[model samples]
Target: MSVQQMPEATVPGKEYLTFRIADEEYGIDILKVREIRRYETPTRIARTPVFIKGVVNLRGTIVPIVDLRMKLHLHDDPHYGEFTVVIILNLLDRVVGVVVDSVSDVLKLQQDEISSVPELECAIDHESIEGLGSVAGRMLILLDIEKLMSSVDMGLVPADA
Candidate 1:
């Protein structure tokens, strides 16, 4: 029902979208993703950070877009093609949008291929990075949606009036 290339994952019945964030490859659980939309004309807010590119209409609900590239000061490779997609993620109890260069295919990483993040960095690395995973010789970083979705930086709240 969606036209998004998620991480290349095929672990038994589990899968994830492995994508490149700058030079790093990261993956998020395919189930958490609501939908991926192509680049839309975002309405610029009068005053806001560059990463926060305002909101867009998804069906009829408004969803915010956060530029993952700008947030990490990562380079955008035009080779990946234009019209970057906005990944709708369901984090915590809210739905947030993440701007990605391009949606990569679903990855199939075995359980053994996944590596947990170092405990030493757990105390200092608060960048929403969950852990690292390896697939077919390539390393894919897993995203901790729980940490990323409820991040104070995004300031997302319940969508109830």
Candidate 2:
């Protein structure tokens, strides 16, 4: 889907579900969030990438879980604590879960509070970033979750035949 066609939490006050990876904060459009689930060990699949933690049966549908820490090349052996949870997302008509350190809070940001991400080389791919949001005294890396998840490198979807 085109950027303009991508779903957003843009109802006057845009809202984001904020979460942490290592020490940095990130946000995703709240509209794409299906549910927040506690950290659970998933059934492992053979020959998959390390970042692909595996899959879980969510009510019958098999949902793939990706560890954001590993995917973003953050912490290698991230400690799963009480706060660690999976943010299940509905993107491109598929259900996937992203493991995060902990959820912070839902933030509502006005247009002025959000700024374009500066063109720079970063560990996390810039294409995945929607923009940078300044709230309170913190900076949030707002993510285009759909683009990130559906990207070819992510291997979440099959390439066109």
Name the candidate that leads on TM-score: 2
TM-score, cand. 2: 0.90
**Which candidate achieves the best lDDT against the true structure?**
2
Please state the error at residue 21 of candidate 2 in Å: 1.0
Tens-place lDDT per residue, model 2, 10-124, is 5697899999989999999999999999999999999888899999999999999999998888978878999999999999999999999999999999889999988897776
Writing each residue's lDDT as its tens digit, candidate 1 over 1-161 gives: 98998897744834787666667777888888888877775777756666677887777877777777766556433223474788898766667788877788887666777777765643223567656787677887788655665555555654341
Q: Candidate 2 regions off by >4 Å?
A: 1-11
**Clash pairs, model 2 backbone:** none
Each model's TM-score, in the order given?
Answer: 0.75, 0.90
Worst 10 residues of 2 by lDDT: 1-10
